[model samples]
Target: MRFSRSRRAFLRAGVAGGAFLSLPASIYRTALGADVPPSEKVRLGFIGLGGQGTGNMNAFLKHSHATVAAVCDVDSSHLAKAAGVVEKATKKAPQAEKDFRKLLDTKDVDAVVVSTPDHWHALTTVAACAAGKDVYCEKPLTLVIGEGQAMVAAARKHGRIVQTGSQQRSDARFRQACELARNGALGKVHTVKVGLPGPNFKAPGVPDSTPPAELDYEFWLGPAPARPYNEKRVHYLFRFFWDYSGGQQTNFGAHHLDIAQWGLGMDESGPVSIEATAQFNKEKWFETPEVAKITYTYANGVKILCSLGKGGYPGGTTFEGDKGSIFVDRSKITATPPEILKSTGGDVKLYVSNNHHGNWLDCIKTRKLPICDVAIGHRSATVCHLGNIAVRTGRKIAWDPAKEQIVGDAEAAKMTTKEYRAPWKLA
Candidate 1:
């Protein structure tokens, strides 16, 4: 579980302002417009080979200009599956490793794609950046508010390109919806309605059992409190447990709420106050909320009502303005007073990224910012985490997005940062 010498040194340097930030530029190709030759195509190492990880790996494999140089996972089964898919596509076997730290030590890996569960996101991302590798990490960006900020700080300090996998940001309809709202075509957006799915915990009464031999349970639980292995506690089911995820709140909310933040032009800021009410599953099966309704009001008086499974409307983000309203989800977009749809969204165009994965690759080569940059992703995730904090504490929390702190509630503010379990720290 040892990190590379460079990664160890970087970790020892800590998050102090000037340590990693001052590293000589000789190690990185910081220039823009440099073409990566065929032989020098971006070298990528992938960690966390689950469903989303495999999907992202497939997308990267489709990129002719990139190489899937390595793969890592705590689950032997998942690692074998990913290796099979990668080998079939590239006609070359990817170097495999069980510990992500070992993968970081590989000199050939120029960038890493982190698709680990929420708890592992910040540490993997920070370690990768410190080791001189760029990162494309999956969303909810971090499990807690403090982790999000640490992730932003890490990427900034190392001058690395970290793209959070909120792929909806790269979709066409979502982009156009945000553009319309931003350009005043929406005529002063006053409200944003977001919807999330309900909790679906299938293992409510299941008993804990020994973990499968194919899985490294200890490593998977890194940074999370120790718990007995249960079939329902790993993989997709991990979303239901607060130790690893924020349930549907951070699950689907990360997507829809992110769009709400984007359309409202609040990517750099957040709501002033939050009001929420949540219900837990009767079975006490999961730690996250069962059903919740959270409302966030920005400083400008814009109010957002997020309904989980109770919006009465479909599951998606809707931007409501004085003049018109636009409802858009992953599948489609609709505009009321439909003629407003024809209006030119104005000259202020957001980044055009038809493909999120391709967008990351292009930015990696050019050293340009991708559409959903780390800071932007962190801001979006902050909104989600704050909503959860409000739900869990059952209090209307006031926030200072600039300071990234809860305004008055001492107990609630502490939830912003969690105590890591042990040796797994948020470096």
Candidate 2:
């Protein structure tokens, strides 16, 4: 069914069996500016309270039109801490819950910012859409290629605005570079160079230990396999493990590769084939490649070479064409011969979002797709996941981007989606 109310209006209307938010309308009239329209204020739910979660939460809280309606985290302490932050800011306590499912079931939440690990992204987003909630989810959008597709389908099926948190997509410099490349300022782009963070074993690693009292390790694991508790495996360090994340190949690759896909005009499609090489630890300290060099070949013959570790092309994505090239990251964007960077004032259709969180909040009002929409994020994330698949299989796998499948090698195709543990169902 089509929606007239954006996610915010349905949230207020108690859509999907959710009750109306407890806060009075007068609460926001004073909490927000008098000049601001009442229809625009959105109460967002915060899920996951790790580093990225808290960072995104604070960023969204800065928006004058946005308020936190609820906060959820697997760890009790982190959940309480995030709730405290919200209460301190609004002088009102947002509902808190350990199970994210409970948070989604609430009508109080207009939209959800999902800052969970890669594995949780698809499930949470898909569930949120089914619940009629808009989503701002972190990248890489999913733990595997199929999950990205699933996310895109759910958002479209439910008419939900799902913005992937590839915030670099909203950066001015990145947009300029993509606009230039897209507008043909780069002149028939042939190759793109992508660089990702090299691997580093966190602090020599720690041994498996008892689960912390404040943490629900089982819930945190969720769909990921059950394993003994290890401090290194719990928080920031979880990226190195394949069960939760795809290492630098996906962590940083998700951002840079996304730029490569956007610049190459390949966000709706992906490479035809992938060939890669990687280094690994003998002791299996990590499941992902320690060092990897991946080559993704497009059906149109354009090539993107991504590297990590020593001799890897400098960090950031660089687009090279016959005329010139442009390289961009959060820090800076530089073009070859320097003068190519000065071109300006083009009528290119780059989604002009100066603020990432603001863009998501705006989309919740407009019923329009955000800068990095669900489909775009899925395609870009597929590019990163393809690199991992090629490394793991040690084979040159052919891909059919249109169908979102492995053309050959049934063995390789299995990596595209993961099997969730009991009590955590993607369906």
Candidate 3:
């Protein structure tokens, strides 16, 4: 079944910035009743208060050590909605700002949660790190490979805690699955299968139009190329476009593939080579592939076959070894031999993190790296990016995990980093 989308019409459909604050992390705190101490609290500022951002805010609200200090969003509506959530929970209104830089500059903010679109993730994270604030950035940690590198650099240089929001690392099922694969419970693992969901772009195409009053369209397009505002192109739907995100390849791939990297014990490194093929929507409804088969080869000869779409492998990560296989997703974990699932997981015990947000908060106090550190997120995202590069260029890409480069392919290498749209550069 070949899915084809017309490129000519879509190609004709469209045309189309901030500073760092240098300061020490804030120790400022407000009254948290008699139970919590002022010195033990982590004042959090939030940037990009959309669906994911709001979700993250609610999670942080559950912790007594975390206090919502401020919220920022390009959309005024989002800012208001987020503020309402914070106010209802804390019984106090958080400082709201249209610009993220102002949120970072606030003396009350010791850390920030960056749930912006993929293009804005790197910039927000690097800037927050430079401002002496810790960061919890959403998955697919960067827009490009180079951006991830820059984020890692800034985090290390500032001595800030930067956690990548690959929350699966905290899930018990995923932890057991990775432990089995790493501890030889799965015998010498040779193949790992990762499945991602198809794109969710169901809306019909709409013509480009004027920006809404509530949205700062220009500011929202920070670091991205110029383009007219289209209702379907902003907010949650931006994942379908190449200029903003790499579709489901990077969206869901970031989560599942990160688990694959963990199971393979390659958090600091990535596959040695990648090859992919994909099909796009026949109506040209969106730019990303509707279905794809990406093959990644690791240095140790472990093969990862990642399939996307309807007829692909079932949604989850499967590790196939000589003795048995372990399959895991958000729902449950299963092993081929049944008894493999009951194994004590040998001597290798992966990091135990029951709550993703809690781990970051604990690390913030201890000054230790969280479960999904910036570097791990970068390596996992590199795998997703390499798969996209292969699919986009229609060629096999040789990668160097140590040097973090695409070997022998100049064209593909260029896709690793994108040109910023004036003023907004990676920190």
Candidate 4:
């Protein structure tokens, strides 16, 4: 796969921190305003048409105020299926392209749904913001902490609404649970327990082989290190590898840990120290930990114990306070005393959004921050990334949350950012 000349130049300008950030104001419309009629639908471009991408497209299609206008993916099969779904639903064929840059170049696309792999999220999102379109990027927001910082910078500088796909933030059960913790319904929460599923890597080591005919292997690697393609190294299996993702630590952690951060009201800041212990696969089939336990100590003396594949703790987040404890997951919200669930949260209201997709659309029109805004996503992801750092290093990590640095550890600090492969840079 090759980049178009204009798209290449667009990226170069973005890398240089020049024209991409300072484009004319006229080119920056989000396609909806007072001048635009109320009945006008917001046009969305779908990128990385994997399972999640296709599902998001269907969610948006259900709303009469939104329409799928474009679809992009490195895989021809995925792209074709996405376009077909749009055509079948709206009776209008969407502009299908193999490159996301071309889809961003389309004049009619008001926003983009980025459901690509973790490594590609930062680049596509920053570029989309530079190109004057809003973004709904999938969670585990960035591959690294520095990448998350770059994304936050791009969104702020471009005045764009960048929503992270941490949909649990919009779920009522999670909301009620967080409200209980935040509103003193739990009576000074001191300990939070978060349980994450273990990595489910089943494939054995296999020889590297030629890329699939329908897939753009090099492009899929993107900013990730160059390596021979393996059957287990792409698609769903990518989560188990360190090169592309941080396994279930970032996968389910992005959702569950995000809830922990929200319930603890640590959206803007994070823990001051972290310590972790992990055990990897005995057979060497996967890279990330098979089972791990991490402890994060916040400045206010709140301690979050995160266990991956640890048998004792239940799945999801549990806020343990002096009075009672509240446990919440996708299924239900349960409290210890039983009466705590009856309280109306005592006016310590949190951001209320029952629908994640619809919240992004609503924020696009009002220019308000979405429930899972990019900054919040970044902070939550930073917590997950820090846990991985602690696990990989096998040591306690002293962190300066205000400064966002790994205090006194130069070698570990370098893990916060990574060098991109040639021709791909984040400014």
Best-performing candidate as measured by TM-score = 3
lDDT of 2 by residue, 240-292 (tens): 89899999988998899999988877766789999999998777777778789
Error of 1 at 133 (Å): 0.4
User: Model 4, poorest ten-residue lDDT window?
Assistant: 14-23
Query: How should the candidates be ordered by lDDT, best one leading?
Result: 3, 4, 1, 2
lDDT of 1 at 415: 90
Off by over 4 Å in 4: 1-39, 310-312, 345-347
Error at 361, model 4, angstroms:
0.3
TM-score of each: 0.91, 0.90, 0.92, 0.91
lDDT of 4 at 234: 88
Residue 165, model 1: Cα distance from true site in angstroms: 0.4
Q: Candidate 1, which segments miss by more than 4 Å at Cα?
A: 1-37, 310-312, 345-347
In order, what lDDT does every prediction score?
0.85, 0.83, 0.86, 0.86
> What RMSD, rounded to one decimal, does every model reach?
6.0, 6.2, 9.4, 7.1
Query: Candidate 3: where is the Cα deviation over 4 Å?
Result: 1-35
Ranking of candidates on TM-score, top first: 3, 1, 4, 2
Write one digit per residue (lDDT tens) for candidate 1, span 186-265: 79899999989987778555889999999999999999999999888789889888899998889888899999988887
